[model samples]
Target chain A: MLIIHTALHGEARALINHFSLKRQHDMNAFACFRADNIFLIESGIGKTNTASAIGWACGMLNVSSPVMLNIGMAGHTACSIGECYIANRIEDHATQHRYYPPQLVDTPLGSDCLLTLDRPTENYPEKCMVDMEASAFMQAAIRFTTIELCQSIKVISDNTLKPAGRMKDSEVESLLAPHTEAVTGLASDLGQYRAELMDNTGATFSQLTQQWHFTKYQQQQLARLLQRHQALQPDEELIDTIPAWIDSGKAFMRWLDGHLNNLPVRL
Target chain B: MFSTIYVEEAVCDHPRTRKILQHFRGRTVIECRHYGELLNLKAQNFRLQKKQPALILAEKQGKKILPAPAGYHIGARHNYYFSHMLNCIYDCRYCFLQGMYQSACSVLFVNYEDFIHHIRQQALSHHDEAVHFFSGYDGDSLALEPLSLFAETFINDLRNISNIWLELRTKSTQVRSLLALEPWPQCIVAFSFTPEDISKALEHGVPAIQQRLNAIDKLQQRGWPIGLRLDPLIDIEDFEQQYRGLLQQLFSVINIDNIHSISFGAFRMPENFYNRMTGLYPKERLFAFNMERHDGIVSYGESREQDMRNTMREMLLEYVRPSILFPCVA
Candidate 1:
């Protein structure tokens, strides 16, 4: 799953059109657009709204882990307009707190530092891309997923030669339009990693629980045992081989333990 | 060949850090207030990072030297160990670093002067007794020697210290720096070995057994005392024949009188580390074996461990004296 967070609709317009996302009328707190395995949230402006929207989306989707990307326009000190970059470092200007997002996967766009402030500022003091919600988005997104799954990409909208007040809504859409492929390309690449992680850790409890009723604690134990069994003996199938004499969950647990322990340890 | 380099703001301008940055001039250089900001984050996938690890340069702020782990000494009254670097260049399936650290990126502590000062201070305090200092506890000492210059700098400085002994433990053949200098008599270039088949199965990115043996032969001919470290003796089919072949190959290259110390131990890991490693690589055959846990340490049960140790000990006794043989029980 991929979740895209943007501060304004103008920034999310190109992605929504590219992914053919439909607006979720029931989502009242924030404007959300959804497609298969992909979600986009227009989390108004500022830090609080961005954070609240991310928490709400993760809860609403009920996903354990999802690839999150915060894409929007940011003011840079000296970068050219329409230039896109993935943020490697993000800092909150008010509190001086910082976050470093690991750049492990391969991406086409280059990377740079990002500074998140409370309000839009025309005076750029640091040589970084200035935004209003990146730090908050990153902090909140990591709470629900791994750091590697959370990333922020910035498209330069204004620089020293180009002031922030001069950019119109159409210009904002144009700035983000050319970079939609880059955003979706990165999301697709990260999806492969998420899939690999899930492949090894998928639950195999449903197959065993069909016949035997188990307590919550016993269910957890069964999951771990099945995981170990699958890891050690990937080629062997044990679910259908249960003996008829093992009638109860307690008895089944004991029998499974004995069977696993009896398996030969071939080096 | 790192694609990205993370530099701590404290050491961004350090001479050593600058020299390293010069080597990767075109790479993406990111600055941070601290190295842990990137390397110590939670939920990092060591397997993924191992695919393409970044370089982190930082200073060693806390205690530069520490007492070696219990039973990790080689016949010395005082044993100390320090890691000038964290994480190894090699990715062995049984490496504890996968569980010990959250990230697989190699962290090079560029501040060598402070570590040297503390090492010298500790050794001088025990001037009358033999003080053994071990490198490669948290990483392979010489794997990054060409870039780190760690062994080169320390060897040149401590060569004259008579009572101090330094051991460089590694499975790497990057010994050119050591070869250029006249051998340091008190320093032991300890080479770790597993059987060729076992190494091919578990140890990734490690030099082949014959290549490492050739490097050891060169160092031995240069008058450098060699140490044989067969720690973490893996269990496999026909274990006796495989281990006997490895030992015979090693002794063929080593001179008996020049052998500084011979040590061997069965595969063992702390319980937490074992659990974490199994979680990381669930399908790994090495972790699939039904092992036993005793006193918070996981191993091949008491009887299997004892049997493997006894077999290796009997074979090692053929070439080296019993006085210099050490059994790492930890």
Candidate 2:
């Protein structure tokens, strides 16, 4: 299940609409909602709050490696104030530490680091961006889950030089609203791909077993022949002739079959 | 599918013990006096075990965290690594664990807290340095995360320690645990990658390159730090394009500004381990590669190794900063 947490409810609501998630409930301290096996918790603001909310949610849910995504606006040090940059690395400046969250693409978005601190750093350098709660949320949420389950996504709302306080809450919500849709869409697509891959793996295994069949002793002998040949793919006719060659036990044919079978199979 | 459960007598009562044992039902329970008895076994057949690997559940007994290799740190000074489990789920023909142990059964050290305690001690000892502790060296970190909760437990402990760094190296795309946590600064959940062609051919039972990349993208979008490791680089025809294409695909969508580090290395294995691996899978094409034995290490001949390394280094220099590009060999 994909568990998304954000500071703003409107943006979360917008995401629910974009992704077609249902409004579940307002569980007192934090608002709770769900959509097609994916859940969202509006955990308010700050690292401590997000951490607490995530912990509470995890305690209430039974999942195998539940993904926690903290989606909100973040100030960028490299990009312009309005542009968006996906954080490939998240760093906790207060702790002088860093982490690599699971990225969504075969190629990562960018090779930049995002700094998470208790408070925004005033006059932050162009190389470092600032976020309020990723570290606390990571620390608390990781306790209830494994590394693959936790993640945070922040859109650029302001430059590090600019105070985040100056950006109105409405402005932050609006900035995240559209991006949330994109993020949700991407998540859905990824979920589908994961399912498809699992299905394909079964077919792959069956094909391998059928294509390569030999007894334990024969497999060992084939390995030697392949090693000597230094080739993975021998002619199919030659492969078919391997049994006959083995039966004959001629030194050269025996050696060839032995070498060919030991070679690693290339998909 | 014979049922087999090798338990460490110490953690026989842990709550998770019952749940773990449940996965291997109808199996015989073997109680070993110590981990050494199992780890030091030499005559086991890795290939035969691949048909059905047993399960080992024991309490982790000694130092859990240790210093990473010299000049191995991507950006941190105090690099430390920990292994809560030993052995892997996949049966890679080249794995060294096969040669190092007597059995091919996967070993799960149930005493996670003990490992955590040792981590605390190590972090305190290197309080002034950026100590990095790497998991998945002895096993695939996340492949069994659901069963062990290993990464989940250790990541939190490492998070509290300011001077320590944690890297969960894996090929598995089991990021459910990582996606749920807020991204940490001191931990790098790096993915070890091979070219799609190489992975599909040689890395059996591992997630595809595209899936791994998709997982990386998801984490990156959610504000996670990502590291790219192309270690033990295999030599292949059109090697330049294969690796370059891999790099291009990786750098294109990866948040380059947020990249923690990128590392690449030529394939090398201990001579003894290679000999054993060759014995197990004599038909493997990987063994047939033009490898040479040098100083007790088996690897591609020096000229080929140098060429592959130099090519990859040059290719990487184009995209990643010098600081983030850590070549495994000098």
- List fnat, each candidate: 0.41, 0.18
Quote the TM-score that chain A achieves in each candidate.
Answer: 0.94, 0.63
The TM-score obtained for chain B of candidate 1 when compared with the true chain B: 0.98
True lDDT of residue A111, candidate 2: 27
Residue A267 lDDT in candidate 1? 46
Q: Chain B alone: TM-score in each candidate?
A: 0.98, 0.92
> With candidate 2 superimposed using the best TM-score fit, by how many Å does residue B85's alpha carbon deviate from the native?
1.3
Which is the leading candidate under DockQ? Answer: 1
Write candidate 1's Cα lDDT for A1-267 as tens digits.
999999899899999899999999998999999999999999988899999999999988988679999998899989999999999989999988788777877788989999999988889867789999999998899888877788999999888898787556677889999988888889998888777666343445776687679999998777767776776678777766788898888898898778877766544
Where is model 1 chain B poorest over a 10-residue stretch in terms of lDDT? B281-290
TM-score of chain A of 1: 0.94
User: Interface RMSD for candidate number 2?
Assistant: 16.3
